[model samples]
Target: MGTTRSGEAVGTAFGEYAVRPVRVGEWAAVKALRLAALRDPVADIAFLDTYEKAVAQPDTHWRERTARAAEGADGMRQFIAGTADGTLVGTVTVLVEEPGTTDLAGFPVERRQGHLVGVFVRPGHRGKGLTEVLFEAALEWAWEVGVERVRLIVHPDNARALGFYRKAGFVESGITLPLAGNPDGHELEMVIER
Candidate 1:
């Protein structure tokens, strides 16, 4: 029965972890979690950034990124599942998409919505329902901000993520985006609406 910065009830704890939004000035934790996620085996499809590139980023980059998603930032929100020992084992970020702006691919946003990204959980933290709790926190934030729909893109080959997204109430939107570097590769778009 813990709450986020916005005071939203983030729901029950799972084992040793509790889900909540990352706080301001916690860039180091954010950076560490992201670096860990990039090192995962499915990093190629699960994220657009590479471990090499992420590690090379200066501290300022991480600081600013963290500030943008920190509590009270209107444009982005990042949720993490922190263990009782203070280790963050999982995270998810949501970006607000305005109707007048373009998506990462330059596609026009048709309406104001929330776009989920940077989803991850440490290898040892997989299963046991941590991911679901993280999603619940992230989605709860989206709905609180008045977004009627939320979307995410997953590489078609990422079966694990696809299954998880579906189980979280996101269904295929039938939209596929071509990978930036690999022309033949594509990611499927999924959405969850109230």
Candidate 2:
């Protein structure tokens, strides 16, 4: 359920739930839980990639994705919140995007940074502070990876997500990116600097 090798108190709540990186061989469960997240009601604004694309992915795709998050030296992390029953309730993936010619959002790279994405909390688990625990673990991972800044893009219209990011100490970086599928959509870039 977790990276047993790194059971270093990633985060805990009520001593019942733990947020941490998934184990190396848990790719199947990771794939299933992430697919469940993509089906959430607000998925359209919450994700740049779609469920159709994710669901159609082969087992190899999920394997690679999970493996990278679990143990990739390239500085990627995927954290999950699990209950005593072993049910995954929330997830957040942080990828260290190195400075380069261009980015997924078509922004010119300035310096090595961490990009937060694939954030999700099951509807039934909302308001439980699980998201906070997830974010804490993610930020810790970013710092461990030597990222100078961590950023996330949220739709300007999604007030809920904006609040969460703000509460986590992320501020508007005064930057934006054209929404991938809908050019008219406004993506507010928010960041927390190390």
Candidate 3:
């Protein structure tokens, strides 16, 4: 566990890595980390967007996206685990969903909640507890924002992700969302109430 420090920073120690929110000027690093995540073997099931699409996005898009998630943003925040030298090794983004808004699946959001998305840890950083630290920062921010709960959608075939979510205290909400191109396949919704 970590203590809340100045700003939205969490003083969690993971060897030489520190977990903190992304900065506006670090857009390039953000884009780089995301692209690397999309190149992973399970990327097809772990991420909603493909590397081809993300790679095609212009620099401006990455800049604006990072700006939206930078510190002080109320709608969304992205937390990253970085080395002492500033190499980002993992990341997770939380998007605050208000009551009455439709989620990415077009389903109504019945309560104020945090939607966890784009969770990734570099392959080399895996098994070092980086992802757990990232999640702690993200969940802390979400609870601070007064969300009722935090939720994440996972592909049914993504066993590793499901196991992690369960270990992190998220339980299935009994909701299954249809996959875009595969009508027979669906994603499961898991949540951790605040």
Per-residue alpha-carbon lDDT of candidate 1 for residues 1-194, written as tens digits (9 for 90 to 100): 25443545354577788787776677998899999999999999899899999999999999988877875476798888888887888999999898989998889999989999999999998988999988888888888888879999999889999999999999999899999989988899999997
Q: How do these models rank on TM-score, best leading?
A: 3, 1, 2
Q: What is the C-alpha lDDT of each candidate?
A: 0.87, 0.81, 0.89
Q: Give candidate 1 regions above 4 Å deviation.
A: 1-12, 72-74
Model 2, global lDDT: 0.81
Between candidates 2 and 3, the lDDT winner: 3
Find the 10 residues in a row with the least total lDDT in model 3: 1-10
In the order shown, what is each candidate's alpha-carbon RMSD?
Answer: 2.2, 2.6, 2.1
User: Which residue pairs of candidate 3 clash?
Assistant: none
Flag regions of model 2 displaced more than 4 Å: 1-14
Model 2: per-residue Cα lDDT over 97-186, one tens digit each: 887756667778789888898898888888988898888888887887788999988999888899999999999989877877577867
TM-score of 1: 0.93
Q: What is the TM-score of each candidate against the true structure?
A: 0.93, 0.90, 0.93
Index of the highest-TM-score prediction: 3
Give the range of the ten consecutive residues with the poorest summed lDDT in model 2.
Answer: 1-10
Displacement of residue 50 (Cα, Å) in model 2 is: 1.5
